[model samples]
Target: MRQSYQDWKGQSIEAKRSQLRGETKDLPVPVHIQKEPPFWDVFPENPEVFKLVVQARALGVLRLEENRNTEEKVIRYTRETVIGSENVEIASSWEEAVQVLEVLACRPDKEAIGRQVSAKLADADQAQDKLGLYDQFINYLKQREAELEKIGGSDSPDYKREATIIKDLITSENLQLDNKSKLSVIQLVISPEKPLVDFIEEPHISNISPVEPPFMAGANVFCTECGEQNPARSKFCYNCGTRLVKPN
Candidate 1:
């Protein structure tokens, strides 16, 4: 009366399908058994690693721009770190990019201070070299004493007259004696004149193009008046003016 279990299990696949069709002839198909779409088809693939690439570019200290399908975004960075500020849009040329970076790097932080200090130091050095002040002063005094002797000979009736003449000679000639000559002239005036006889060369008094006074002889000032020369620091003219011309 009842179907044998072995008979049901032994049926061929087609026989089982026929029997299942006969049993479910009046039932609708099951919803759970319906086929599902493949996993790859459901999730689309992304070709680019945009976020990771942006971070990598910043590590290299490069500013970059990414052009998406409909819009563009800029990324700015420096050698030390990425700048979080808004991205700057500029010309796309390589030369323009390089120029902008160079300008930023080369800009001085303290523009005025740096320039002012540099100019002042340059001026001071120029003044020191141009004047040769110390050397000139020593030479001037020595030449003055020699001039005093030439015109007065220590006992001339017009000592002032000789001094005045020496001063005129110094101013007009523009005599620029070296260190050695200045010392020799000083010796000639202070020591016995016989030893320095050769040093004296008839006082080469030539007319300078432009006549000037207070010609420096050696270590003294030759007076334009009275022909009497005096020490370099003399306040008054030895033979005339109570006040001497101040040495510059």
Candidate 2:
């Protein structure tokens, strides 16, 4: 047989060198491979053996050896058709893929802090409804300039043109106000012995009408013993003390 297949391949290469010296006899001492040089004395711009072969192919420890002249069933059918088999073997080295993309870009998220606290509570409720409509238009222009200084003759030019039209309707930055100056101050305070013109001409016709007697301008009255509306110059019931009565 060819010298008995050359002594069975020299006893299968001394039984794989005594089973690789008994599996490297408790490990440590193996480092000697060095001398490879001569590809014109090596260093072809040495990037440290291409960064240690890209850190041993990213730590999966760069394996590949089995070719026993190829065909151990075509190298175990090309290592069982090799395709990424569930990936995750990491370490290939751009600084550990930039430290795993900086730990997934450091967290933050609650929908961007709830859209910045809903845009600062809608800019503090539009600055508190524009400071409550500028204090109800400056207390209706200081009660129409104290009822045009109590009816005009404050050295009249119709009291300096209705106090410069109630100081340009309360310092106008245009918050509006002229419904013909509140209907010419409600037709200069109506009169048929004004209990606001008998509560606007008998509001619910005559509940014994006529007791709100004092200088009546725009009366209001109500109190059938305490419903309390009061204000035709109010002699009481400033919200329930009760006793005011004069329109009869």
Candidate 3:
């Protein structure tokens, strides 16, 4: 399997690009690692493998895998990394990938473990744009909200609330956004066209209310509990220890 992967790896990103353009239908795997399923799982359900792919891209090399046969479950991951080569099968399920990545993590430095974690944490550019994606999602919510307002929808208490939050986030930029909420929003946005009624239900992650960790500083993210102003990078309120919004 490793040898097969090695053979498929192109000499350069351009080479991979050419291959992607030609046959494999090469998809862009961004630096932002996805936590939820499908859009996250569409690439690799395993966080470990997903994280590794993110690191590889940062290092100027990224593996572009081709699953030619879905039935056979063959995942040919041709690494596109600064280094010469590396490959690992993420397995059929996330649980399986965890086992796979765990084994790889224990191997010598030559193994893919160290190389994966050593890369830079994804920024706004390299990683998937959760905010930008949410922007589209907010638009969807707004449309839904407008429709609901017409009917006096009972399910979604105030669709405008999410819109207000999203609007505030757009202007202020320092607001503490929840990561799980971001995932939930993204999931709902691209989801398989659910009923308007189903859509009205509050997002799953919104209930969890996990605080979003900020990508950058300079903005002030407030605490959910005490409403204390905290830095964008602050995970908890200095005074309240409450989860800060936007990002920690």
Candidate 4:
């Protein structure tokens, strides 16, 4: 039997609460809507929806329309479907959505979700709220750092990407992040030594000649006055300083 909207919402709330209580794994969206076209039609008009669409397309679960070529077109179509609006003026919103989409598209892992949450937390205006979120952010960094270390360490693309996000967060002047949080974030990304993979054997150049031959044809100029055999490239004789005749 199909449950009414209220019943579904109630179940959603229960699931959320269970997730928070560690009784169930937290999912960003309802299980029914995750892979269903009917729910996709009514998906929320947000970055998460865009991420889902991109992920679906990447995984061959979704296909672009016949004429949709550019990213702006994709962005427009996403808005038109998710928000039920076709009048959106694509400007800074497109840029912001694109940034979020790129991050989410590159990573199909929970780390991408964590980055989104971190960005939102960094945007908090109230100092108290920021202070409260700082511990969570630190925990995220620690977990991400450990994961990266296990897989590919500091040289991993994932590590570099997360480090870039951390660097941006710390350097953003508008963010109200505390000094301690900033320092702690910095400590996670930087390292004193380069990765071993970066070291390469230098090629042997010790026996290579530094000087070139007189010419490609081994030609030389015999000075008329001094009989000095100067290189064909020389304009003047090396011994007598006399102008060499053209060798035709």
Candidate 5:
């Protein structure tokens, strides 16, 4: 989840210039500039998607915590903005996590965090609605693009993803899938050749169970540079304006 000092070539390290930023050179500064690790670099293939995850987690739009259920380590991203939430667990493996992060990072808006996630099997009770979530996001994407005049733009948003938000009023409980299966579904949704209708797989969302119990988890994220404790979901530390490096 973080890059080591060896991996960070440009970020700053401790210094002894005896220069204080705010106050005159009367005493040593309490904090030095320490850059946080570039976790997005960890997912070069899906940088944008991974970036969204970092941003959303920082904004408290979603919550991430250690997944103690399995022997193979995993981290869970559970929606917290809304009352009844939906969550998805992604593996710790960097490469596999990239594939899963792309799907989770497809959130269309910051509000409805995980609405479009695994739409194929998100809500079995409202299979029709679950299937329609992707379509709704597609429609919204088109409208958003038109608003931004991004029909032929380069910096346009990738609302075409299957996991962006398309807020649902009716709460859909639990939805979790193995890394392989989840990645496959995400790829299929983003595939140009696959028709939207094909995203629907009957009984896909039938396994919906109780939502994950909310945990009072935050401020656990720490900055490796200045040892600043950042908010749990923070991508960077506020004190020294550095990216958070996973502590050793």
Candidate 6:
């Protein structure tokens, strides 16, 4: 990935212009590093492996393998860091790692773990895809909240509130940090067929609401047609009376 970036950067302005015009071969795009289930979910079980992976990410080399013949299932990871190439083993196999990661990715506790890992990343760009993960996590919690309501029967209102709090944290912070990240999450979570500007202008359809209007600090419904911004909870635009949209 580093070599690809360097090669692309080495090209002259005329070469890039020719490539963009389809008069030359396409320029190489830098490959981004992303974990299948996100490292935060399973790595919490093996801090040592997680630390090494974090360090390795800075050097742009990371590989994972299943460790066989161990008393317990284990995962072996090889990473290239400033010191050199290093191999480390965690007490979980690839399959076991996948299972734990799947569970945590769906659980509300993932928000806490994801935040910590996102904070520790040496390259913030590596975490750009995390908004999609948080989007999926929020959706999972939303479904779970409804399931808890049905199962807990009116006896446990507070039980499902925990899900709401976590969802808010993801929506209000994690998913809102960068517009590019938000747009990426929208493309992955929302209907990709929809125009990005349509979602940006009408964030209620973006699945990450209530979105605060740019002119103000708090959530508001901005009317694209009439140019009126209403309070977050308002169902219709107070000025134009256009019905405000909300995520299903």
TM-score of each: 0.14, 0.16, 0.23, 0.25, 0.23, 0.26
Name the weakest run of 10 consecutive residues (lDDT summed) in model 6: 54-63
Residues 1-248, candidate 1: write the lDDT tens digits.
11232132223222433443455332223222334312212222221222122122222223455635325444333221165533233213322332222222222311222343234324433323222422343344344345456665445534443344434433443344444445454554543412321222334533212112354768676556565666786655545444455456
**Per-residue lDDT value at 167 in model 5:** 31
Tens-digit lDDT track of model 4 for 133-173? 44444454565578678777767876565555554543452
Per-model CA lDDT versus the true structure: 0.35, 0.36, 0.42, 0.43, 0.41, 0.44
Q: Model 6, which residues run further than 4 Å from truth?
A: 1-65, 69-72, 75-84, 92-130, 133-173, 176-248
Q: Rank the candidates by lDDT, best first.
A: 6, 4, 3, 5, 2, 1
lDDT of 5 at 240: 49
TM-score, candidate number 4: 0.25
lDDT (10s digit) by residue, model 6, range 73-183: 344444345999644442243333322333322222223334444453323333355554455555555554565676683246543444544545455445444554565
Per-candidate total of colliding backbone pairs: 25, 10, 17, 0, 8, 2
lDDT of 5 by residue, 10-109 (tens): 1111121123122334433333255333353443465555544433432334344554444545444555456575455443543344444443232233
Arranged by TM-score with the best first, the candidates are 6, 4, 5, 3, 2, 1
**Superior by TM-score: candidate 1 or candidate 6:** 6
Comparing 5 and 6 by TM-score, which wins?
6
Native-to-model Cα distance after best TM-score fit, residue 46 in candidate 3, in Å: 13
How many times do residue backbones clash in model 6?
Answer: 2
Evaluate residue 61 in candidate 3 and report its C-alpha lDDT on the 0 to 100 scale: 35
Which segments of candidate 2 are over 4 A away from where they belong? 1-108, 118-122, 127-226, 229-231, 234-246
Between candidates 1 and 3, the lDDT winner: 3
Clashes of 2: 10
Query: lDDT by residue for model 2 over 1-248, one digit each (tens)?
Result: 43343344334333433454454323223222553212212112233333332222222233223434322211010111155432121122323321221222211211222233334324433333333444553554454456567564455454454345434433543333233333334445544332332222333543323344353455677666767566666665544345678586
